[model samples]
Target: MASTLYKWAGLLFLSSFPYIFTLRGDFVFDDTEAIVKNKDVSSESWTDCFYNDFWGTNIKSNLSHKSYRPFTILTFRLNYIMNNRQLSALSFKTTNLFCHILSTVLVWFTYKIVVNIQHLKKHKIDISYFGALLFAVHPIHIEAISGIVGRADLLCGTTFFLAFICYDKAINSQKHSSLFMVVTIILSAVSMLFKENGVTVLGFCLFYDMIHNIKNKKETQIYKFCNKINMKRITILMLSIVFLLYGRWAIMGGTKPEFKATDNPAAFADSFTKVVTHSYIHFLNSLLFVWPQWLCYDWSMGCVPLIQKFLDHRILCPLLMYLYGIFIIRAIFCKQNKKFTKRILLLSVALIILPFLPAANIFYPVGFVIAERVLYIPSAGYCLMISFGLNKIITRFNKYKLGLIAYIILLLIYGLRSWQRSYDWQSEYQLFVNGMLVCPLNAKIHYNIAKVSDARNKTDVALASYKEAIRLYPEYYQAMNNLANLLKNQKKYQDAEYYLRSALKYKQDYPAVWMNLGIVLASTKRLKESEQAYKIALQYRKNYPDCYYNIGNLYLEMKKSENALDNWLKAINFNRKHELAWTNMIALLDNTEQLDRALQLIPNALSELPNSPLINFAVGNIYGKMDRFEEAEKHFLKAISLFDRKVQAIHYANLGVLYHRWKRYDMAEIMYKNALKINPDFKTAIRNLISLQKYKNR
Candidate 1:
């Protein structure tokens, strides 16, 4: 018992020690859309997870990514609430680490059940412990453990193992067989809810039952494989899987997720090319398991070019991999091997193949060409295979100590690699920079670099990277849209308009591009064209608050105050915490001498966005209009404090005007000079200062 406890402790420490650095890592790559910006994960209405896709878009919407993982989103929501309604990377990452550790423990338990069922007691080495240790330290899991958004796979893997364990119990315990079967069904469903491929656990259970039956019969014939199998239990399991699949189909509105060629280039290739490239991709995935030396966050956007010809060098790897698979299968059924060995090999292969089938692009196209996170569950099978192989080597050569030393060396290498890879995920910049090192030809990597650079206000680097991304993938509309946004910010209207148009040519239905085009058009004085673009954007995305806000800006440019106010109100209706829309609506009302109406709206806006500097500034202006001097002064001070980085000159100028109105000439003069310090040109402060001097003389 003490030895068992020590082994578990060792497994726990091995699982967690390499990933300790992940606690300091920030959300990177898809983590931004899936956690930081995802409304479903942060919203108070937790039920929204049921109706929205994983990234918080409505599940039925065409724009949705269609990854319906409500249970995973719920966990993210819980993480958000636990962190005081904030998106704390540490909290999310801590949960990821905990899930990964839980999965590692579950892998140990599940492997123990497999070992016991196969009756491998004659072996000197603890194969279950060895497999669990390999799984705990394998470097392939870095993406799933280090990236905060990979919680889906982590959670799914945990439940998958639990479901399999329950199925094993059902097979062995006649007294509680029915009860265990029910629990297995529930766990399987929960697994699928966490991640789509998790439904494959049921398949694993079915395969296990067949193998167990075959082992009992000691039969090698295919006809006798199901001779002694319990049909009733199999029927129940099959029915449950069908029902769960139907439920998933109904939830997704019976529509397959649409993907562009860039997402899975091989999926869109010619039949011959698709076959060869997909086979090569399988080889690449296997290679990653064998030697995880070159890892990248994304393996899409031309990372693996299509194998167009039969003689392509990449084709050789898949052929070799297939030959090895055949050899393993032959060895599994070989008469010389013990029945326990055959069971282990068959189960290990089932684990590797079944969980991976969903992502193999054989059934349907996935959004990514290759995702390391998707390999999390499949790696369990891989670790078991490696452990079994090593055991065989040690026994055949009669060199236990040498085998142990070699195993320790392998663990050290993988653990060190994992620790180093965790550092790569510490920041988006580091992650993408390392991805660039791995696959410099990948356009998505360059695009992500541009995005992070743009966020940091490194405009030149952003522009260059964006251009490179577009050059690498001509049909990359997202890169073009982002480049246009940067160009628009630089007041290069013509260049911005050119890229926006080019982007529209590729993705006409993209609302963000349309909205950006509207802004660029309005900048170039094409007001009518800008309005049409905003309407098109709104047409594509009915609930786009940013599109509505831009439309309001266009109406203001057209001097249509009522239209502007109405559109801003619509923006606020769609997103109650939209600071720009709220501030603009209040400002327009105050400008039109609707101080009472503006004051009425302030409380609700403040409730939703109490920390918004723009909302506070707008409220201060309204209070000043109402002659509430003390309240106005308080709000202005709060806005200044909230602005943090650099208080806008307009805010100080407006406060100066409030002081001027209150007849505090000295304070008003000081405020004007402060505003002038921020912006040397300072038209508003310059005019206000001269007027203040005249008032002082009076």
Candidate 2:
């Protein structure tokens, strides 16, 4: 027990040492979806925590990513809470580190229990320790452990390991107790909340127990003990699997559409040959365990070629892995004499294969052809294979010194590589730049870099990357859409129109593409085509608020006041927190002298978006117009208190208007000057100050 503790302590330190560089890491890629932009993770109320989908609010059309991972998302919410409701990469990365450490420790604990239960011999070599070390330094797991968004894999892995350990305890415990069994059942169910891959924990446990049952005779106490409880265990395991299937199927409805072709290789495989090709490539990628180097963040489309021949060179290694897996299966269920070596091999394969079953596109699309993070749980098998298989060969020659030296050298190389990779993960820009070097032809990497550049207002870099993305994959509608948006922002309406048309040529059904096309058309004064485009967007997607909002602007420009108000109100109904819709609707209400209705809507809008100073400011102006001085004063003060930028000069200017109405000309003058002080170039403040001078002269 003391030695086990010492080993785990050392392994924990070893596993975490290289990741210290990631302490300063920024959230990248899916972190944008999973944490930074996921409103559920940043919500103050627990109702939002439980009720919201994985992507947070469903205001935007994200059917492709309709996920129910409340448990995993809660972890992200906890990090948000710790960071004071602000999205901080440090807080998320810290939680990831914590999960990694816990998982590493659990790996050691679970491996020991499995070996002990299997009645495997404990010699000078502890296979479990070696397995744990190999797992720790395996560079394939870098994406899962180092990337903050990959916490789904980490949380799933941690829960799966605990469930496995609990299963072993339940089956092997001398006292007849279903307590451990019940815990195993609950843990298995809980694991799925973290990730869908987690459901395989039941299979891993049941299969391991089945193999152990084969090894132990009926007369043995171990076999007899389990025989009595095994039926109960099986029942519980079956129930868990049933619940998982029902939840995913019933809750999510059915298979999600692939919004992007690269989301799932198998799903995107429009032909049988394509499916076989992608399947083989996926298997070969995982076979990287045998040669654990040349790790990549993203593999370009067509990088993995089709397996045309029966015995193709590209798929040879993958074929061998399949044959070995067969051998391991044969060894486990062979009725005659079962070898301990074969049992270990089978168990190792179980560790690797079971967790990956969910990602087998045969089940459904899992939103990636191959991601290194999904290999985190499966990499445990690689560790076990090395410990049990390679360790035996080394000990046979009694070359402990040689094996030790080789192990140290290999870990040093891997550790250094991992350290270098950690730096790539330390910044969002660095990851994309590194991804660019590793897979320059990867359209998604370039697209992601372009998005980050657009966010930072680096228009040239964004344009270049977006163009490169389009160059690599001409059918990339997202790149086309984004590039058009950039061009639209620059008032390159012709270029914007061309790109939006190109995007429509590829993905005509995509409402956002149509919406952008409408805006570009409107900017170019093609009012008829613009209206058609907006109507087409609304026709394709009924709940499109952006289309409604844009059409409102078009109507307002055409002096169709009633139509404009109707469209803006529809936009607000679709997305109550939409600032433009709120602004437009309240403006129309104020213009029509429906001040009471505007005041009533402010509370509902406030409820939807508590922190929106614009809503408060708008309400304040309405109250001032209604002659409710106290209420107007309160809201104006609230808006001013929340102001964090010189761009908020309008709020102070509104205060000037309020004070002027209240017959405090001197106070109004002070407010106008303060507004001018904040933003010297603010024309509204300049006009307000001119009005103040007129009042003073009078």
Candidate 3:
């Protein structure tokens, strides 16, 4: 008992040691949309997860990605709640590491069951221990472990192994068969709810039962198969599967997810190209298990070119993979081999092939070309096969020391690689830059690079990366939209307009692009065109507060103060904490001399945005306009203290004006000089300082 406990402790240490560096890593890639920006997982009601997609959009909405993993989102919400409703990447990643350790232990137990079923004699090298150890430290699992959003795969794998174990117990046990079957059904359902591909575990359970029956009875006749199996339990399992399928379909509103050609280009290609390319992808996925050296965050947008011709050299890879598969199948069913060997080979192949079929792009199209996280479960099969082969080399060739050395070396190399990969996930910039190195031609990688660069205010680097992304994939509407936003910021309205229109040519229903186009049109003084663009954007996404805020600005330019106020009110109704909308409304009211109404709105705005420096600044300006000097001074100081990074020069200049109006000449001069220190060329501060000096001289 003590030895077994030590073995599991060792497995836990091996699984978590390589990933300790990732505890400090920030949320990168899909973690932004799925965790940080996802209201379903952050501030929304817990039950909302069941009604929304993984990214927080309603599952029935046309814009939904239809990834209904509520169970996984619930885990994210729990993490958020545990961290006091703040985004703690450390807490989230630590939970992911713990779940991964749980999965590693589950793999160990499942492999032990499979080995015991084969009735193999105990040997010096424990296949279950080594197989699970290999799985724990495999470098290919880094993507699933380091990325916070990859908890879906980790949770699904845990429940998948648990479900399979329950099914095995149900079939073999005499006294507790009914209880075990009930547990199996619940686990299977829980597994599928965690991830879409987890339903394949039921298929694995059925395959295992069939193989177990065949091995025991030595049955060769196909007609006797159904009689040998427990029909009542099989019927219940099939019914449960049918019900689960119905539930999944209903949750998606019976509408398939929409994907563009860039997401999975092969799915939209001609039949020959699709077939040839998908097979090549299968070959590539297999290679990742054998040699997981080339890893990237994304594999789309021409990362693997479509095989258009029969003569294409990549086509040879699929042919070789198929031949190898055939060889394995023959070995599994060969009468010349011992029964134990046949059983081991058969179960290993089932483990490899069954769980992977959902991601094979056979029944339906997926949104990615290749995802490393999907290999987390299938790697168990690969580990088992390799561990068995190593045992064979030691026993058959009598090279025990050499075989053990090779096993240790393999673990060391993979563990070091996993440790190195964790650093790439430290920030979005590092992660996307590493992805670019692995897949330079992949336009999605370039687009991500541009996004991270734009966030850091590196405009030149951002522009170059965006152009490269657009050059690589001309129909990349997302890249075009983002590049147009950067150009708009640089005041190149004409260039921005061109890219926004070009993006609309490809994706007309994109509300974000429409909103950005409206902003560009507004900058160029095309008020009517801008209003039309804003309306179009609202038609697609009715709850978009940013669109309403922009439309309010447009109405202000058109001299429609009432209309501007109404739009700003709508913006606040949709998003109560929209600081820009609240501030703009206060400014408009002050301009129109509606000081009393603006003051009345301040309490509500402060309640929603208690620490918003912009709202506080607006409050100070309103108080100053109303001649409440003491209140104005208090609000201004609070605003300056609450400034996120740096207080703007205009804030200080406005406070200087307040001091000047209150007849505090010395304090007014200090405020003006502070503003000038922050921005030497600030015109408002220079003019204010000149006027204050004249007053002091008088």
Candidate 4:
């Protein structure tokens, strides 16, 4: 009983591991859209926060049209309800830590329950213990456990383990409790709600039951009994659950479509090939988790492909891996093997590895195909296999003390690695920077670090990083476009144009890049070329609202009111929140003798960008155009207050005009003088003040 209690204590520690360490880290990777900017999760409505409505309608439409496990969403909603959704980093991190601990505990209990079901009692299954310990300290799991918003992985993993544990108990118990079955099914459903990946547990369950009965067919006659049980009912229940989970995806339509690469249909073929290639790639990820010498959050780990075979060539890593799998299978199934030990080892390996393959979606390669969060459930299986293997090895040694010492060293190493890995995930910048050390050849890593550097105002560093990313992967269209935009911001119009052209070479139909290129061309005084670029972007994606707004801005620069109005109206129609388009549309309407309509549009524009500096400046200019001097003065002052010195001069000059129009000569002179004070080379202020002096003399 004392030894049993010790085992229980160890299980509790593993379960509570997440709560033991807390780090308040900034958002990283997908957390930005999933948590920070997610309107539904951040909203007060319980229904909106918890349900999939936000996913299908808002995020899926614009960004990713894929189903995520909904259990995570519910966790976010719970956090919101518990804390009023207002959280500092510490509070948010604490919630993640709590969930992680809960999942860890669930993992420990799930293993204990499974072993108990087998009734192969060995007090010194230290191999299993260390496997569980290794799982607790696996560096790769930090991304899922340490990050605050990764509560989704924790909640989903926890529920998945719970459901598995209950299912094992229900299947193995002599009395076969219906309550356990009901609870397991309910928990599985909850896991599905948290994340799409959680549905994978059911696959494991089906496979485990089938395998367990097969192995026990003669010895326990379990096969005959299980066959008598309504296997069809179980299969139907499982099918119903799967359909209920993913049926909406089929009804709603397929996943979000990606733009064809280089306008080539052949790229589709390449993408399909990438799916098979990715299986080999994904297999490498599991190998790392097993050995875990170097771990990275970014999935774009580099390995050169073999060129000899078009279809049947096995890459070295995957080839060796396949051989190892074959060896393991043969060892488990050989006629000379001990039946119980073989069953245990095979089951452990299968549980750890099989369920993960579906998520890898090996037939379709995606960007960052391997992620740590994907391993949350798989880790349990890995730990059990490792623990059982260690025990087998220790039995050969005979000297228990030496074997125990070896186990301790292994656990310590894993613990230390895990602790170090946790620090890397403390924030986005740190995670990207550290991940780069392990995955330096990954273009996405370099690109991610460049985004952070840009945010930190390290423009030169950002430029170099972007350049390096493009150098490594010339087909990296997003990096090329971003580098061009960065150059455009620095007034390197010629260089910007070159980079933009390079982006177009690979992704010719990218609407955003085309819009950006157009904006840069117009700035460089290439009006015809700018117009051509804008027209091309609109041709590709007719509903692209930003492109329409950008083209409208170009027309406005050329003083083409009719052309500007047409584009701005199109922009507003595409996105109701296109505030700049609305503002520009109102200005164009006022010029076209539609004062009432223009006036009516002001509130709508104000509603979107309320108190925004640029919006206030635009509003002030509109008031000036309408000859509402007092209103113009009010808005101009507001704009000036929001502006930094460089932009404030424009507001001051506009205010001087408002004063002059109102016949406030002294005020006009003062305002003009103030504008000149702010900017020494204030051309408009200088001319306005001279005119005011002449007026006074007359």
Candidate 5:
């Protein structure tokens, strides 16, 4: 009992030790779309978490991810709820780490089940310990552990193992077999709910059942497989597969159209060429299991060289295919009655190949060439191969400590590498910096690095990164739009406008490019052209408050008072905290002598924006107009006291107007002089001071 307990504790500790630094990690990659801005996790309606895709409850166009992984999203929602309805990075990240830990424990149990099979009892090397340990610390899984969005893979793997373990017990059970069967069914659904790849559990169950029957019957060939198939078990597994596929088709509208050339990779290939290239790419991804180094977050097109020619560096493709067939044949035959033959090989192959099917992009492209997170499920199989391979050596030569030394060194290397790589998830900047070094041709990594640089106000560095991204992938319109924004900030309006137009030329479907073009055109004082661009932006993106706000400003400048008021109202409706719209509405009301209505709206604006300096200052101006000097002073002083309010000479001059109306000529004169001191050429301060001098003289 104590030994079993110690093993469990030891496995959990080994799994968790390398990932301890993840508690300090920041959200990166798809973390922004999935957790940061996802309203489904933030809102109260839990049904929104299920019915809609990851993008949102109301997906207009499928430009963004529309994956229906409700259970995975539910976990993130639960984390947000626990963190007081705020998206706490630590809380979200800890939940991801928790799943990794749970999967580690499950891996130990699953490997134990593999070893304890009736045909494989003699090879008692405790692969359960080392298999789980290797899987726990594999550096390739850093993408899954460090990034919050990678939880889908973790959840899918956990439930897949749990289903297998439950099924194993069910078959061996006399009492309550039906209950276990029902639980396994429920787990099958739960696994698929976390990720579309969860359908692979069906393959796992079918293979396990087949291999079990084959071991008892002593059969050896793929064609002569499952000669005595249990109709009941096969029927049940088939029904599970059918149900998952039907549910997926019903929920998500079959396959989506690729939004970019890179999205449809097969289009870049000519029929059989793509299949062979894709096969070679798959081989490379699996090879990482043996020697997991130069691990990348993305391996989009340019990042990895494709196998266009038949005689390329990936020449081992034909050999790998041959060896794969041989492994299955050898496993089925069990010619040597080796413990690793029948069950282990079957289980390992199922683990590697089943989860890989959905993401293989053989039927259709999955929008990217490669992503490491997709390998999380398959890595379990790799770990099994490694654990037993090490076990065979330990059994062969106990006297020579060569295998033991290799095992120790392997563990140290994997463990230390995982620990060091966990910090790459500390921030997007770190991940991009590290990833670019590993994959310099990955356009997405360069683009992300540019965004981080721009956020930090390192414009020169950001410009270089953005240019580098475009150099790598010329059709990156998103990077072009951002590059234009940087040029706009530098007041190179013509250059900015040129890039914005070029962005539209590449991808006219993007609404943000139109909006940016509107802004850049307006900066050049082309009001008609700017208005046309804004209208186009609205046509593409209906809920754009910024576009509405800018349009309102343009209308006001064009003397279209009613149009300005209507647009500002729309902007405020969309985003109540939009200070520009609220301030403009108050000014329009004040100009039209609708002071009472303007006064009522001030409280509403304040409720949304409690610290809005413009709102407070405008309230002061209104109260002073109403001859309420005390209330006027209170609000005006509040606005002035805020250091972030960007106080100017006009603010002090406005204060002078307030004091001048209150007939405090002495105080008013001081205020006017202070305004003039800040802006020596201010006509308003000069006129106010001269008028106050006459009152003081009296």
Candidate 6:
């Protein structure tokens, strides 16, 4: 027990070293939208944070969209609260290091369980420790462990490993089989909450069981395979029913919401041909974890080929085909190997290949087929096979000398790669910049880097980057919209209008681009054109508060008071805390002498944004207009105290007037002087000072 504890501690300490240097990293690409800038989780209402409509909501939208991974959500929330409303990038990042350590421990435990499995035919493949070491230090896992929010991937992976171990325990009849089953189900559910791929655990477990059955049975082999086929069919039926029920809740409940082929990979000779080609590519990527030269977060869209060109060069496909044929023949004829050994080989292949089928570009081609995270579950099989292989090789050789040398070299290489890769994941910006260096023409890399630049106010650089992204992949609509935004910033109204139109052309229903285009038109004095853009935007996204807010502003500028009021009301209805709409409504009410209604709204605005300088300033102005001099003075003083001096000059001058009215001449003098200190040419302060001197003489 002590030795096991020491191993766990030792692994965690080694895993955590790279994180010490990564703490000060900035928020990466999705982290901005999902965590830092997402206001829903920022709100006091946790339920609202989870249930928020995914459409226009910021980080809160991440919950309901893309499989609603609540584990990631909970992680972010915990960090947010622990940081005491001032979450530094470091504080958020530390969590990922701890999660990675946890995942590594799980990986160790998983290997140990697989090694101890009674069905294993291989004798003492002592390389299990080396395989675990390789997995622990593999560079491919950097993407899952380095990014602060990527704890989701590690969380999913950790639970996935645990669930697999639980299945093995249940299969071995560890006396708590039913308890293990329940634990497996719950962990698998949590895995889904971490990522959509978590749903594959159940399928993988069944495949493992089937492989075992296939290997063990000789007399009943045909009947067993046939019965299992029917069982697979029934399982599919049951899962379909469950998905339909979940779909009803998901589809209606959404609060928000490639072609490849090297020379006919499909038209290849047969199923053998397709599987060989796909598996070759899959195995190559899986192999990269051992010897990762080119690391990338995304290999999608541009430059990179569908499959590595080397597979064809080496005639690997034919060789793999030959091996597969031999395996089939052995299953049929050769009765030499132990059942356990055969089962291990069969199950290992099944685990590695089965989970990947859904994403293997057969039924549908997901842009790029290669990714490290996609290998998360599949890597287990590879690690096990390697460990077993090691155990076999060591028994026939000098166990200590050769084994130690080989292990050291492999660990050194993988560990060095992992350490270097971890630096790239320090922040989204670093990741993208490094990824581009690795795969320069990857459009997503350029797009993501451009997004980070745009957020940091590096608009010119961002524009060029976005254009380059568009040049690389013209169909990238998100880049098109971002490029339009940059064009708008340059005040190239017509140019901005053209790019916005192009974005709409590519994907006509992109409401954010429509809203942006409307903003450009409104600024250029094209109110009618702007209104049309906003209406079209609203048609596509009825609850888009930003569109409603922009449309309201357009109506206000065009002197359509009633229409402006209607749209502002709609904006406020969509986002209750939309400060602009609230402020606008209060101003409109004050202008039209609806003082009582306007007065009532001050409290509402205050409730929305407590201690807000803008709200306080607005309240002060309202109170001054109503001739509530002392009340106005108090609020104006508060506003001036809270707000920046440059912006709160009017409030200071107003306070001077209130003091002068109450016969507080000495205090009025000080207030007027302070106002002039803020703005030298302050007309209000000048006039108020003259009035204060006259009042003193009287």
Give the winner by TM-score: 4 or 5: 5
- Pairs in steric clash, model 1: none
Candidate 2 is scored at a TM of: 0.79
Lowest-sum lDDT 10-residue window in model 6: 256-265
lDDT of 4 at 359: 60
Give per-residue CA lDDT, model 2, range 1-698, as digits (tens).
99868886879887898777888888777788778887788767665644546667441234536566678888887888877878888888888878888888788887787566556575447777877887777777678877877888899999999999988888778674478888887887788878777889999988887877766764475663256566667777778788777876655555463445565444555566566676676666666665656566676453344466666665566567678768767866787633666677778888887888776666566666567888889888777777776577676788877877777787777777777788788777888878787667678889989998988899999999999999988989889999999999999999998998999898889899888888888888888898899999999999988889999988877788788888988988998778878877777778788987887777877788766677677888888998888898887888787766634677888888898889888988888888888888989778878977986899
What Cα-based lDDT does every candidate model obtain? 0.90, 0.78, 0.90, 0.71, 0.81, 0.69
Backbone clashes, each candidate: 0, 0, 0, 14, 0, 9
1-698, model 6: which lDDT tens digit per residue? Answer: 99767766667666676445666677765567767776654667665444443221432343333335556766677778888967677877778777777777777777666555453454543445556666677667666665555676778778877888887776557478667766776777777667656766777777666654554467565645457543653365347436633743473354332133321333233565445555666555655645688888776665343333444553464466558648755863558755655555665666566656645756544435466666665666666666666665676674856766776687677777777777777777778888898778777788888998898898877988899998877777788888877888788888888888888888888899889999999989988888888988999998998788888889888888888888988888889888878878877887888889888788878888766666666777778788887777777767676776445566677777777776778988998898888888999899878877886789
Output the lDDT of residue 202, model 4.
75
Per-residue CA lDDT of candidate 5, range 488-524, in tens? 9999999889888888888897889998898888888
Worst 10 residues of 3 by lDDT: 219-228
- Residue 420 shift from truth in candidate 3, angstroms: 1.4
Best by TM-score: 3
Query: Residue 685's C-alpha lDDT in candidate 1?
Result: 95
Over 4 Å off, model 3: 1-6, 218-229, 539-541, 680-698
- For residue 403, model 4's alpha carbon misses the true position, in angstroms, by 3.5
Provide the RMSD of all predictions against the true structure, rounded to 1 decimal: 3.3, 5.4, 2.7, 5.4, 3.8, 6.6
Q: Against the correct fold, how does model 5 do in TM-score?
A: 0.89
Tens digit of per-residue lDDT, candidate 1, span 1-698: 99978997998999999988888978788898988888888767879999989998888888877899999999988888988898999998999999999999999999898888766567757888999999999989999988887999999999999999999999989799989999999999999999998999999999898878776664555544454447777888789889999999889899888888888999999999998999999998999998999999999988988899988888899999999999998998799998888888889989999999989999888888889989999999999988988889999999999999989999999999999988898999999999999889899999999999988989999999999999999989999999999999999999999999999998889999999999999998999999999999999999999999999999998999989989999998998888999989888988899887887899999999999889899999999988899999999989999997779889899999999999888888989998998997989899989988986789
Better of 3 and 5 by lDDT: 3
